[model samples]
Target: MRQGSNFLWFLRAAVGAAILLGAVLLTACGSVEDVDLTPACPTGVGRGIWDPGSLEGKDAGPEVRKLLESPRFGATPQAVRDLERGIVDQRLIAALRTLTQEHRICVRAFKEGHYFLPGVEDGPRIPEGYGKAGGLPNTHYYGRAADVWWVDGKPVEGNATDQDVMEIGEILAGIPSGRRPDQIIGPPRWARDLGYGNQRGWILAPDQLELHRDHIHIGYVNGEATNETR
Candidate 1:
């Protein structure tokens, strides 16, 4: 009986040690994935780390208010006020800044514009396929989207050309794919790879929607309208 008790004690000690070692090894192997954008706002009001399952409110935090106020967004003060009515993602704000910087030379050289220019009558409206599964694919209601008004050297609405469309498409497509399904909505391949949306693609076609031709729609592709509204 003494020998059996000693053996049991030793086995228990071995198991405890093994568990501790496994935990230490797992902690040592912890990964640090790169995030493309650091959210300017806190984890609330539609401005948290990108999550497709989550919906956010339209309330802008201090950081978001600062972004809206910046001239770099290319929106007049009034236009910014209008956009603030809908909820926008923190990632989209970061993406817009990145997009503007990426196209600065083109904008300067060819007079391209972004967001809302001074005289533009309209701003971003909800895309036609806001709730469609394979369409815009979980964007719009939460303000994770925008419409760019200029491409190359002309206005997107009535003046953009096929070449302009291709150029902007490549740029928009090149934005790094999101870590989750709801983080992005674009090419069907991209959506499929993330394990969401149908295979038909998310970019609206000219025939499918007329106004889309003038301006390219950009979004962080997070969450459905029904889920978001509720």
Candidate 2:
């Protein structure tokens, strides 16, 4: 009888162990169904018409020019050059303006030597298989993506946990669904330990997380545009 009881106990213990392991695995591999994928704020505040001349502060009018020239919403020289060449999405500029003006968050868009190039340079190297969507080149190539390494005058490297950095990520993530950035990867804390797009939240895989430790990468759908100019 004792032998039978021991066998039963062993079986129960094995089952319990298996259950525990499964739970651990489930938690480690977070389920998309379980998490709230809905955008935190879907107001579409930053949506703006695509004006290639906006980068030069011309076609979009004086307000956009003022915003682009503002110290609070500055960019690196290379980024400025890219902007002058009309290489960034208009929505991104609007988002930057919103971040700076509405939230009082100073943002330096794109690290120097990095703006719209594909291969990689300073800051975080674009992870392999990233940047491309639907058999097309990466969003950066199409000017729909940017990497901001400075916020509130602080470098993103050591300030990943800073309030400004976290807020920036949160705001970017909260952009309206559909027009929202499909890729919003930043420091671990603000990104909810994952990301916020691709039907699974930004950082699709663990491998992509490390690549975004030093900068906030924001990429939108390639062809999206708005009719309203700033």
Candidate 3:
């Protein structure tokens, strides 16, 4: 009886020690849920006050034109065609240009579809039972969103575990509030790692995560800037 009790105790101790060691390893390796990578805003560039006037314009402004012509940024053929025909907000153009130039990252923009028109066939048709009911229409419809599927010659899909992709997502998330997009969606693991687990606009829900796994969606409010920062 004494020998049997000693054996049982040893077995329990071994199991407990193994479980503790596994937890330690997970923490040391910086598991997604356990890691927090809230990045610091650049010097003198903390979240700036939004200038409502910045988004008020009927046509693509000079800055928007310049950014579209910039070599730092690239776009899909469909995106180029749609962008030329559609009017994109200037603030979004500025943000994308800055993202590409500063990071030396190749940003390939893609269009979602035509903006929602009253009677156009190919124009904004939200599938029934899709997304949060009563949610706002797709930002792309307002030319306030851009989808990036490729970065620096690498496809964003199937590369969620890549450090480079995570770093880029982090940079986008870290942009000062009012300057960054209102909705930034990327890989599920990296999104959580960047402290966007419970963020209002950042992707966290399972449905959103699945839809955005292939691309990074940067969306802005039509006339106002979002108020979220690292």
Candidate 4:
């Protein structure tokens, strides 16, 4: 009788262990199913957040943190497969990762004073009061988009080139042939007057050009350029 009881206990213990293992596997699978992963990225020599898979920086939240740590977003998933195939452009993929992180109407990398082009001059330094779009005192607007050049820990000679910066203007122009939209803030008339429509057309409110002469101020609902949803 004692021998029989020992056999039964052993069977129960084995079954319990199996159940625990099954629970762990199920939990892991569930977690994997709940993350958004990007694909394998080309290793750019530059230090930008081009690799969305490594998005576990101080800026990420729980959802982003979980996604970065999971297999679906990490490897062996459609997003990863797309990246490996070059089905998605690395720059565009990086941009999308940035755009989706917040409900930001516009995403820009702004510097100080002027719109961040490759070069600058020593005029009266723009004070703290200066901002993009209509960023005026006592009357600031949200989603009036703009970008400034920013490079951390690198000494700038005040004569940077397009190659050094991510010229989004050039990227937007190439979108049309690829079956994407012409652009949100299209090429300037200055560019078109020079006649280069062999590429896709650009998109920006013609009337507001004067107001945005200094910055590429993108507004969401000014009855002009309100395409913040994309």
lDDT of each: 0.41, 0.57, 0.59, 0.33
Ranking by TM-score: 3, 2, 1, 4
Candidate 1 residue-wise lDDT, 104-173, digit = tens: 2011110122322245422334334323333333344445555555543345455443454345444544
Q: What is the TM-score of each predicted model, taking all chains together?
A: 0.41, 0.57, 0.60, 0.25
lDDT ranking, high to low: 3, 2, 1, 4
Off by over 4 Å in 1: 1-72, 76-78, 82-86, 104-139, 162-166, 179-201, 204-206, 224-230
For model 3, residues 1-230, the per-residue Cα lDDT tens digits are 99999999999999999999988889787676544322122223222232324434535456655555554456644555445554566667777776765443333343444322334423233433444422445666667778776665466788876776777776676667677776777767657666763344575666667667777777775457565544
Query: Which whole-number lDDT from 0 to 100 does residue 36 have in model 4?
Result: 30
Best by TM-score: 3
Better of 2 and 4 by lDDT: 2
Clashing pairs in 4: 37-73, 39-80, 109-148, 110-148, 186-202, 186-203, 220-226
Clashes by residue pair, model 3:
none
Best by lDDT: 3
RMSD of 4: 15.0
Q: Candidate 3, residue 185: CA error in Å?
A: 1.0
lDDT of 4 at 203: 37
Clashes of 2: 6
- Residue pair clashes in candidate 1: 156-214, 157-214
